[model samples]
Target chain A: METDLGLWAVPIAMLGGAIRVSTPILFVSLGETLTERSGRINLGLEGTLVFGAMSGYALAVMTGSPWLGVIAAAITGALFGLVHGLICSLPKVNDIAIGIAMMLLGMGLAFYFGKPFIQPVAPDLPAIPLGWWSDLPQVRAALQVNVLFLIGLVAAGVLWWMLKATKIGLTLRVVGDSTDAARALGLTPSLVRTLATAAGGAFAGIGGAYLSLYYPGSWNEGISSGQGLMAVALVIFARWNPIACVGAAMLFGAAGALGPALQTIGVSSGYYLFYAAPYVLTLGVLIATSSPTQALSGAPGELSINK
Target chain B: MTLPKFSRRTFLSTSAALAAGAAFGPLPARAAGGMTVGFIYVGPKDDFGYNQAHAEGAAAVAAMDGVTIVEEENVAETTDVQKSMESMINFDGASLIFPTSFGYFDPHVLEVAPKYPDVRFEHAAGLWTEGMPSNIGSYFGYIGMGQYLNGITAGHMTASKKIGFVAAKPIPQVLLNINSFLLGARAVDPSITCQVIFTGEWSLAVKEAEATNALADAGCDVITCHVDGPKVVMETAAGRGCYICGYHADQSPLAPEKYLTGAEWNWAGVYPKMVQTMLDGGTIPNFLRGGLADGFVKMSPLGPAVTDAARTQFEATKAEIMKGGFQVIKGPLKDNKGNEIAGAGEGFAEDDIRLESMDYLVEGVIGATS
Candidate 1:
């Protein structure tokens, strides 16, 4: 039985678990990366994540197409972002607090709208495995990842290139780095932030769709633990880079799956301790990478928290 | 039945505060000129658990008669419930309102029920009646019956005589299930010991999976849940090979290898009767408790894999229970401690105690407070 849980099992299970669990985190972090790229932070992304899960699941069941659930979730997420943008854009409203309120509202809306889709059957996302080259069953199983994992990776690489080389990416980075600089250059910071936030919202929505349609395609109020909120911490860990976001999210996924994997080996003591793995890792990495005075590597200069 | 001329935009607007039209089942429409009733929910109507059952029941009522039910889903706390109640009364003309939440008891409903004497109200899962108006009454289910059956299956499945239960709050409704599940499992194995973990939220699939995983680690082969969703439980056990029983619905399809069997409440058996009674010019009977006799509660489809030994014993036990010849909470009881709960030969009487306030985990349960 001990052989059943060797170092190979842990890493192999983690590879599969990371992809399964990291899909949502990748979407939300990528979304946050876009919003921050445009000189704004959407703390309300957490609410958007859950609400999207609820809305996406409900719509998929009602519409009879899971892909439509993804589309519906994206629309709802964008709308939520639009509302947040509108609220923050208003004269004196604080974006942070409005984000908190939007979080509450988004959750409330999800719980309300998502009520019916809880038990209904919806389409499940198809997983694409590239591990066929591996002769080992465990390695082959680990390679049985979802199409979204590959998409998330591609999105990260594409987003990284876009931010580094594209005109739109340069303008967004400039807006985030300095609102005054953006204004001096004849670009509206608010406009850039708003559009960026919309993109972020779309990502958050897709992230929620991952929870309902792919990781486990079905609806329930309990479907989301705190993947949305945790994505915020993940974004900080990623330093607003989509590439880093994938790595950090997979790490968190591995941490999240630790307890389950441990059970297979018959280690049950201190089970509650395992529940703290992700949060602990997140905090540890944040503390390790954080500098009290120096600007974080790759962090946007104009960002308030980063500075 | 008051249908204030249906303008297209205000099709659901009856005068209730935010008492918007809601869907029950496959169909959703505003009751144009139908006697509009209002239903207020503490959570979403599609929770696939308790809330879903109530919503389905309300929807069944809407299909028949001078009745149109509008639900305000995801209404906030008691304050919001009260505000929604007012909206149902003063804003929308809800002659009958169902406050389908456990917390909306004395403070929310009792305070408001008397003022709105014209509106008939039904408080789900409430017992207080001191300040309640004549128009209001409370009702609930003997969900313990289903829990008991589930425990019997757990007893059958546990090779080690060890099982786990993941619950929401330690409130009476949940405690009742824990206690009854123990009784049922014990009735079969007599040696089965159940350990329970609380997640504090009916929903929270992640925490639930974590908790269940912890239970699986703790050596529980048979797991049962009193949560809002079954997906997490199903998926977590799918790979680990733990046996699972679900609440609210049969999720055997979600994880066939792991899903042992589940117990569910059938609103189909109860809603039509209540609606028919109301249509026949009678008020919904106050505090009506329904059981297997009335079909208000039902066991979900037993998985094809349930053993003949398990099935035979379950059917016999169910028949006795249905005939009222057996009560899971009946005599020869003892608390978790070795102390005798009842007199040596005595049985606990129903009239002497309230099942909702039970906090102790009888014998054979390894559970904790809060």
Candidate 2:
């Protein structure tokens, strides 16, 4: 097969790669956004993401349904979050340290349990061929979007709305703003943060499910590649806003797609440099957004690390 | 702020002294009174590719007499690997250790080998030098021959004369496989051109899939790869309806419909032999190299997608390779940049060190190593 699509194919392929790669990041960052908004940071979401991937893949392989695998992943992720939440809720327990410990636990458990699920091919999540209207093969292949990506977009919108328009959102916000204020308002800060962390973990887990059951569609140790950690940075970049997380994830995805996209255009020189695009973009984002004198204006007042 | 800081030279000397002391440490007594061999893998045991190939070999040796196998999976090629080796030595009392990843050769294996001179160390796909410790050995198979055979199948299967190669890195071992595959394909169809994409990392599943899709979108009817795991590449190519030739292990099960064949490591054939030779009081060669005749590497069974003619050709090539006269990286070769690698009348021997350090792609290969 000799494709003569030429220069036009680069952006099209990149667009496709961006959608495929960003789905996980979108889910994870959205999850991180919720956690950070509730005055907790779960750095162990990387472990959650990996465990989710392993659980999702194993369940999908066992059940022959990718959706069930996804649900399993979400549940597993939520459980990890719950553990992190409970452990950190104890007096004098640092959330950051607990998060790091949980992350290791999640990864260890996943690696230990994911041993048998490595080779088996699980049912893959389906993709919608939005590119059917295109005459060009490159365009058509590039436009084949997975269903999870749409769900992620909807999740972003719903999360954004929930954060602004609901009583639960107000209570969570009050809990995040000040524990004293929450106590005065007769709210349990620990319970609220724990639920938020669990919710965040569930979102990260769905991202993991997307990795194992959708795009790359396989279970392995290297599947996450620090995307879970990157989502933490992404949350900061998004100012802990769920809607902005979608945009940030897509941007990261586009950066990641840059190398392969250039290769299609016959740009092979210095190819390894292009693989650093995402990391470079992340550094650039941090440099642009961070102010040394003060925390980013949108950071919750009760967020201990910011102090 | 009040802490004392050591000078760079002082720090270096102290660390060097510590390493040397650790290296020349007194030998610990064996507890089990039997041969215990340890195998460390950089990936999962069932990655269906690179690590799995080694694990299979480990399993082969595990069944041997008086041998206790202590296996550690997901061991990275960093200082962390040194800890795993130490644990295997100090805890499991392993007399032999196989740190199988390519990157484990330098600091990790070198650092650990001297510490336990009594223990034999065999690293896979390593470049061992004269200056390295005597107890350390390197073993690798000529899997490029299998790649060449797989290329022949791809050449016959592809109607469009365009093939895709998804590679982990542009290192010599990977480049050799890519070039050999292209050479074999060109032997069948002179006009066949292979577009190669390097994913930079050994196990970036997402990049592997994207590269496969990009290749398919570019009209590459046939695809192959040299990544740590071929699962992503194989599945993506099959998903994109492209014929695939896998690497490291047989991935036909992943994409049976679109699978053409694969170049696989036959570590099972050599691991037992190596261990048995050592058990029988024979020295394991410092640099062990084997070819198809020795059963170090073998081609996967041809898939339904492969034509009968391609199979016949593959069999003939296999027979020739087994007869000990086949050399894939022969002379009369020119790199893709049109530089003469070998003159028309000259070629390197099968075990040529030049092949080990191969830096350029052969003619008909489309990609830059840089």
Candidate 3:
């Protein structure tokens, strides 16, 4: 079983790694996009993501079904989001401050409850084997994309359409663009933002499911290396567009995979620098796209950062 | 990844245990003179990895007479460990503390040791130079010898003649293991090559898994690792149908069929002896090091996948190690870059101080230290 494919292996491995790694970020960015689009920001998705990974892995182990674990993760994430949303909707409350608190609260709860789950082995989500026609093992290994990624792709498109043409999308936009405008149309801004934030949390939870039930496929205290927080920067870099978020996530994934992919081919120089590649890319993208003179394009008017 | 931190509930529970132990734990022979010892870990004690090995040692010390062991798991290596150490001394009446994590040695233990000169702090895998405080000591096992044994089994079982190592960092201890694994395999078959990948962190599960898959992809039939927790690497290798050798603790339970052999710390053998020496009014060494011959490290039971020839070689090698003066990094050795590490007839014995600062991979390894 000689797994080497010479120079060809690097790109193929990176391509596969990119798709696999990007799924969680894509799901998270999409969730963040949803929350931000409704005139709210849930920095607490970091907590939601970790909690989701814990609950998802725990359920999958107990039920022997990965899908149930994903459902459990989403439900838990939604509850976390609901709490965050409820607290932020009150008078004189800062969403950012509440979000940071919620992040700690969510992680603390997960660690406390996730203690017993550290050792249990959960069933992994199945891969689609998109490279079934390939004779090369590298191609086959690279093409073994998980089903969550496919859902994420559809999710990005569905979210794009749902935010563009639908009446629900119009209401969300109206609420996000201006609170006074939404009130003129008899829309409750807090209610809209709360539900939207919850939905966003559900998506972030699924991203966590992708982490513990698919790629890394285990529950531990260190399972997530701030991929949840990275999604915040990723969403901003994508200009708040769901479709763009997918591209940005893949780019970040490729950057993240650059170090290991190079190591596979015996390229070991600048190894530590590669660990900083994704963060570098994020900073580079943010710098190139933003101006000191104006707010970011497509940014929600009622979003706290914009204000 | 940031190591797990002790939660409020965990801290409270430890406080309760410390208070209870302080009040009631007394040996009849030394009831008035019993000493309280504290052990701190950077992760959960049952992680089935590095922390677990240390925790096992702490448990062994707990069973000894005239010693009250107070353990606080999930203490970060930050200034938080300083607080834990202070609490152990001030609140729990501990005079001897073992901060088991490697990172705890630096500023944390150094800062606190001088503050409490009467309290002895023994850190694992830290370099204790002459200028360091006398109360602060360091002890480490030469577990690379255990990895060498693992390589012997891997070399025999490997069908591809290419073994793989998934390493957490390119530090001295990890580099030593990587070199030793290759040297051990090369002793069995001269043609064997060990490909190495550094994940750059101690507990990045995603990178560890990817590195294992990448190694399996590169035709490595047997994989071993030097990571904080070998759980992800072992499971990933086993999942990919590659034979795996574990590190830090016994991981045969993770991949029973694919498990070959592993390098494990026999701290339970080392810790009790040190504590017993301290209890006997003897001074513990400031700088302590040992290997298989000294009962500081041991190997996991050879899995069913290992052959009789491998078993014979492994046992013979074990006996040779037990006899002492066994040199793994010896003559005719060139680093991967063709630079001479030792002259054609030169060799460094297992306990040589220079080996502790090893900074290069052996000739057969495929990765760079940097």
Candidate 4:
């Protein structure tokens, strides 16, 4: 069972595992950051993620093109988000409640439709080998980054730039900051928020695609494992910043990779505890950063969550 | 049926009669006019994993003469499952109920069984004690036997002499399968080793995939898993160009060229017999266990990737296990931690509670229990 490699392998494996594991979280949290920035919370992205996973995998299997599957997943996610946005726009409708209901609906639909795709294998997304210089097989394998991870990194930068510099970004910020201000400015807050939510859903759909069409690369009911929901907490931890979402996601992925990394180095005691490292770290971050008496810094003023 | 207004003495007499009936009278049958069986699954009916395995079993029983089967899918192991069972008994008039999830046994089954004494409850993958209720019985397949067979194949095919296992938890059943797989591998090549990773979830696809990749990166040439569903593991490993073995169901179709063999549940072989035994008014044993010999477990057909030598060795090992007196958890066994689990010539019988409660990995298993 012993590998001849020295002690340096653990950190190297974790770095690679972090990149692989964090890709989904990065995409999902970035999506949530957009939605929350526009003063809405889509708790139902969990469902969207699963639905996207199913739709993405099923389409890849049917179409034999992984990119097409990703597009389909994004479209499906956008549709789910559009539904949530339209429903929540009704007078006196609670977005949080609707988000929960939509989550169940999305998951139910995915499971119902995903049954046939469970046993079939879908085509995998291609990966870029980045470790050609390394002589060690472990290093070479670890550095084989998936294409989606690179896309997610680019998406993070683009989202940050768009949210900060674009006119659409100003409109979303104004609407999220104060609905009354937006109405006075002749802009419909609901419409802006709805579009933002849809875009968010689209991003989450890609995250789901990453889960089913790349890393795990299979369609099943248990594909997402609450990563969609975890992105909500991750967004909060990132102070609703898209760039910070990437870092936060990498932190989570690194924590998740800790157990396997340690095992590769033959440090296997309390393995289950290591599995819980991500959650524990998330909890610790939340407790340390949260203020009891004041709204969180950088929180969108019109956002309904936790207020 | 209106109740008659009764005087105090009449009420007392009626209460006494009811108490006497409850204490000494034969329990009424739960089913009213037909044999109705109910199954509750923790996942969708077609998950191609543990739940699907049970669903297939329920379908088999449904095919039996004069038997009707009703199922509630995606039921969690909570009070919600208890409610589903009650409704099946009350509305569907199901006499026999199978709550197939592992977590359903402790509080849910134990709490519900006493409320409906006439209804027989069969739980899968449970540890039943002597003091447990008589109406509730537990059964599980010896999947380790099939896993061992797969291990022999893995042992022979692996050029690296390192195999990877993606396991769900550190529970005894899972540990037993892991150890047996390693033992079977080492039986062929004494130097073979298995590197295991527990994903901490029964059906988390992403984690299972990551673990599979991690193992492959660590130089394991062959990979198998004890996850609730083997879809992601098989797919990930195969996509990574690694040879794969599966669990819970046959997954060769997922990756034909990379597929080896899988440890599959043969619940269809046992469910009909169980239903028949119940229909014939026979008591099901409190602790029912069976293996490949009795058809409760099976091996998926070997794929083209499997060599003829591995196939021969696997078949011979399987036959030896089927002939009885072949114990996988035998003497001179030391845990991965170097502690002697069983000294030379000292071993627990197959199906022994000690074996059932296995807590350590055998030697050459590169994994931890905690």
RMSD of 2: 4.3
Q: Let me know the TM-score candidate 1 reaches against the reference structure.
A: 0.74
Give every collision pair in model 4: none
TM-score to true structure, per model: 0.74, 0.93, 0.94, 0.91
**Regions of candidate 1 where Cα sits further than 4 Å from its true position:** A1-22, A47-119, A126-172, A179-199, A220-226, A237-299, A304-307, B1-37, B129-136, B157-162, B212-221, B231-244, B249-261, B266-290, B330-346, B349-354
Best by DockQ: 2
DockQ of each: 0.21, 0.63, 0.53, 0.46
Model 3 stretches with alpha carbons more than 4 Å out: B1-33
Docking class of 3: medium
At residue A117, give the lDDT of candidate 3. Answer: 87
- Per-candidate Cα lDDT values, in order, are 0.74, 0.87, 0.88, 0.85
Candidate 3 docking DockQ: 0.53
Put down candidate 3 lDDT per residue, A59-132, tens digits, no spaces: 99999999999999999989988998899899989999998998898888888899898877889999988989
| Candidate 4 C-alpha lDDT tens digits along B114-194 | 978999999998567799899999999888888888889899988889989999989999998899889889889989999
Can you write out model 4's per-residue Cα lDDT over A1-307, one digit (the tens) per residue?
2255657767777787788889888988888889989999999899898898889989999999999999999999999989999998889999999989988998899988988887777788988999899887777777889988999999999989998999988898998888999999999999988988998888888899988888777777777878899987799899989999989998998887788767766888887788888999999988998899888899898988645
Q: After superposition, how far is residue B20 of candidate 2 from its true place, in Å?
A: 25
A150, model 3: CA deviation in Å? 1.3
Off by over 4 Å in 2: A289-294, B1-33
DockQ comparison, 2 vs 4, better candidate: 2
Q: lDDT by residue for model 1 over A190-254, one digit each (tens)? A: 77888888888988998898888766555665567678888976887998888999999999887
- Candidate 2 structure quality by residue, lDDT tens digits, A1-307: 3458888777777787788899999999999888888899899999999999999999999999999999999999999999888888899888999999988999889988998888889999999999888787777787788999999999999988998999988888888889999999999999999999999999999999999998888998888988899988888888878888988999888878778778866899898889898888888878987789976878888787776
